[model samples]
Target: MAQITLVAAACVLVLSHSFLPGVKGTTFTIVNKCDYVVWPGILSNAGVPTLPTTGFTLQRGETKTINAPTSWGGRFWGRTHCSQDSAGKFSCLTGDCGSGKLECSGNGAAPPATLAEFTLDGAGGLDFFDVSLVDGYNVPMLVVPNGGTGQNCTYTGCVGDLNDSCPSELKVMNTDGGTGGVACKSACEAFRQPQYCCSGAYGTPDTCKPSSYSEVFKRACPRAYSYAYDDKTSTFTCAKADYTITFCPSPNTSQKSSQGQDTETTAATTSPLDFNSTMVYEGAFEESGASPSILAHVFRSHAIVGIVGITMAVRWIF
Candidate 1:
């Protein structure tokens, strides 16, 4: 009986080892190298998110990190206003524009409001990341249609034709030989290229006619269309920009052991264990080694031996 109990205990220990949980660690580090300051945020697979504690102050080169959890994945993005001047208005002091000014060309205005979007994918895993400004100007624009109808158009359809007129706002202004309200007809004649001049009333030139604005916007803002930045090897010219994405693979925990040093391996390892698998093992062992039947047996045997020993002691004394 003693030997049987010892065997059972040894079995419990071996099984316990098999049931032990396997935890994985994942981490991500982001570096911001841009003139504009930013406060970055992070998202996770479980839908819980986090924001930077001190908020990143991107003056040129700065970095931060998010430590490991059960599983991790999401985007990192940020935005802030262009620095304002003493008069409490947006000012572009970074020399990002060609006219040595920060305001948009149309009546000292800025481009329509916009935001950046980024997407990331990993086959096995990824970690360690950096994003740098390719150029100084990463402003968002409200994409408008190509026609004279100033409705919101997709990025591809809004060739910077903010007003969505047949002759774009820019074309109309350039054609009228000035800015402001010049009639479409007169403006078309002034700005019409020889190839674009179809027999028309004025702004009705073939080139001035409505084409897809989305295509034009892509041509104009190819790099700015997406949220990516790369500082090295890319030109910072007005027409060219750059951004970057970097990551490291999460550690693998599914490796298997072989029989001997010279033994040949048979199969490839599987994906690292997940949080759900660990939870299942923990739940299975919640009442381990203390089943009701085992408890009752222990109590009954103790009671029977106590009663018999007590009776014998009393008779002997008498």
Candidate 2:
């Protein structure tokens, strides 16, 4: 009887490990290296499941990690100059999702915000990612892959302080007493012309060429998407890997804070990956154990197996 029970238990374990799809997922470690508070916003792509938290506050030097199921697609950004009014409505000067609260729900970031976009388990089973300045620049961001494969799996982001050098017409100035610039607006947002906006006849990538303004952004951030059609050098991909997204990744940022406060010394930037080094894919939930959502699925799977296994074991014993 004891031997039969052990065999049934072993079979259950094997089956669960072999067929559990929910066990596989990706992880994102978000870090804030800025001198002031940063509110990170997340928006899952339409038709996909939303992440655990859509938005949250991160103090200087703080870090938070979240998990995403395989094939999850979304974008992450930072909100600045946020405050709650007397009516308890939350708002931000830049990168606001317009949810009226910390959580962005299903909303995406407003324009003039730096964005880190991702599509996990995408075409050819690769994770496609990029830091885009196409909507314009509000902060310096870096996205680094951890333990992934493929030649294009590497570091990508915009570390330059574009606000300081932003063109006068494209700069979003701080409304507060400080005269410093807060964000840099894209040419499309500034002029709304067919050429810059890539609309009407310029809708196709062939018709839309990099404008002089986009060139400025490209020169500053070679790996980031500067214009709508800038995909060749901007997009990066990796297979079966987790990611770390850092805000204000530069060791030193000359741009002033959105609150117009004198910036303090910020944290040093992280070291880039050594390509020669070996990478091992440590799955998101595997390292930290299953999250609540994953756990729910895990338990449900086990319950089904448990019932069958026990019934078989009892029949064999009888």
The TM-score measured for candidate 1 stands at 0.26
Residue-wise C-alpha lDDT for candidate 2, range 1-318, written one tens digit per residue: 678868777877866764676456787888887777899999999999898899999998888878787789999999988999999999998899999999999999999999999999999999999999989999888788887899999879886667767899999998856677789999999999999988999999999999999998887778999999999999999998888888876533564457764332221122222223222111211233335665466456666777777777677777
> Candidate 1 — what's its lDDT?
0.28
lDDT value, residue 281 of candidate 1 = 20
Cα deviation of 144 in candidate 2 (Å)? 0.1
Compute each candidate's TM-score over C-alphas: 0.26, 0.78
Q: Write the per-residue lDDT of candidate 1 for residues 1-318, one digit (tens) a residue.
A: 665555556555544433344322222344343333543323333353332231233433454443333233333333333354577654432211222223222121122212222222232222212221211122222111111111211121111211222234432222313333211122213344432333344234223442233223323334332111111211121111111211111111112235343111221121111224443122211211223343344345445655555555456545
Q: Once model 1 is optimally superposed onto the true structure by TM-score, how far is the C-alpha of residue 158 displaced, in angstroms?
A: 18
What's the CA RMSD for each of the models?
A: 26.7, 7.9
